[model samples]
Target: MNAISIKGLSVSYDRKTVLTNVYMDMEAGKLYGVLGPNGAGKSTLFKAILGLISSNTGQVLINGEPVEEQRKKMVYIPQKGEIDWQFPATVMDVVLMGRYPFKGIFQRLSQEDKNIALQALEDMGIANLRSRQIGELSGGQQQRVFIARALCQQADIFLLDEPFVGVDITTEKKIIEILKQLTDKGKTILVIHHDLSKVKDYFDKVILLNQWLVAYGDTEVTFTEENINRAYRGQLSILHRTTLD
Candidate 1:
């Protein structure tokens, strides 16, 4: 079965349609890049799959089951802007939150959980900064902390929104490498990305959206000039100068 299946999904806010009759199936062990212009419903699609928002029509199935049934199997790393940097949390405190889904209502974290969280921090190369305040970290370090949390969760599917924004080149490269490694382990990942130039290198497949499903398939085959033009629409001139050439 596909990792995720969306059938006739639509969403609206205040009577303004954000997505319309979108359908797609994502497979496991692959990295999918969700591409779209601003206000193209990329984030909405993530919210729908994560069951954070009610869809106007259709359903989202995870591994052939309703999303609610598989909520613990997925992890969502939202955009940095959506987070509160001054929440007074430490690196370890944030990464340990991933284990909350596994604990019972009154259960306390065990040593094993701490070990797992520390391993994730080590994997992200931030183990030494485990006690640092979250707000004290740089953008790249902050992104790594969240990804470490996802790793600690041991979830099968990951949804990351614009992870590369505001990060250094080295950190960007490292993060992609880690994501690719996860795919190699049969984990499904979807990223909402805006850099058309890196799509070819960063993702195995592409889901082009513009308030609707435009094109989705292997990057080399589906990410063609024509499909890009169709998705970006009036933003072609800007993309041409920055990415498409």
Candidate 2:
């Protein structure tokens, strides 16, 4: 199924165009990486897709429906740098926030909800840090906690921006493992990544972007030296080894 369809997409602020007439189809049950350099409008593209900002032109459809209704099945894990690190909340408390969709304005959490949240924490390997305050966690721990929060949502699609950034090697591996598991379960994933060395191994496909669509397909075909150099806006290339599977 086509999870998302974007056509003639364009976004600008104060007459400065960030993305030019872009069109793409994101398929279901696939892991797609959005590759771009700084100021490449990758994050802006995601925000537009999520309807965080209105686009002056183009139409974005999710699962053959308007974006608003289909957004319920979507989950977003923002960049760690974007989060308020000083928020006075515990690891468990953060994970519980993912369950907010299941609650009515006046409703309280049930025992089943609590158990599911705990299970999600465990799945992300943060069960031990349940009681720890969010600010006290290390860089890697913080990423895992955020991922745990997303897992608790159990959404069909996961959109993560710079998920592996500012984390330890161990934490990076754990996050990749969790992503692989999601792929195994047929969950569609879109991740904005900067690291070229690990891109081919971590992602099933790459969508090279630099304020425009460069290439969209398998890494073996699209992540070529010439393509990467052209899309990355410099002397850089995607290193290919093998898929995560």
Best by TM-score: 1
Q: What's the lDDT for all of these models?
A: 0.93, 0.83
C-alpha positional error of residue 22 in candidate 2 after TM-score superposition, expressed in Å = 1.4
Give candidate 1 misplaced runs (Cα > 4 Å): 238-242
**What is the TM-score (0 to 1) of candidate 2?**
0.90
Root-mean-square deviation of Cα positions for candidate 2 versus the true structure, in angstroms: 3.2
**For candidate 1, lDDT tens digit of each residue in 1-245?**
99999999999999999999998999999999999899999999999999999647888999899988998889999888889999989999999999999999999999999999999999889999999999999988999899899999988999999998888889899889989998999999999998888888999999999999999999999999889989989686764646753
What TM-score against the true fold does each predicted structure earn? 0.95, 0.90
lDDT of 1 at 60: 94
lDDT of 2 at 132: 94
lDDT of 2 by residue, 62-178 (tens): 887877887667888898888888888999889998889889999999888889899998887789999999989998888878777778887778889998888877878877888
Clashing pairs in 1: none
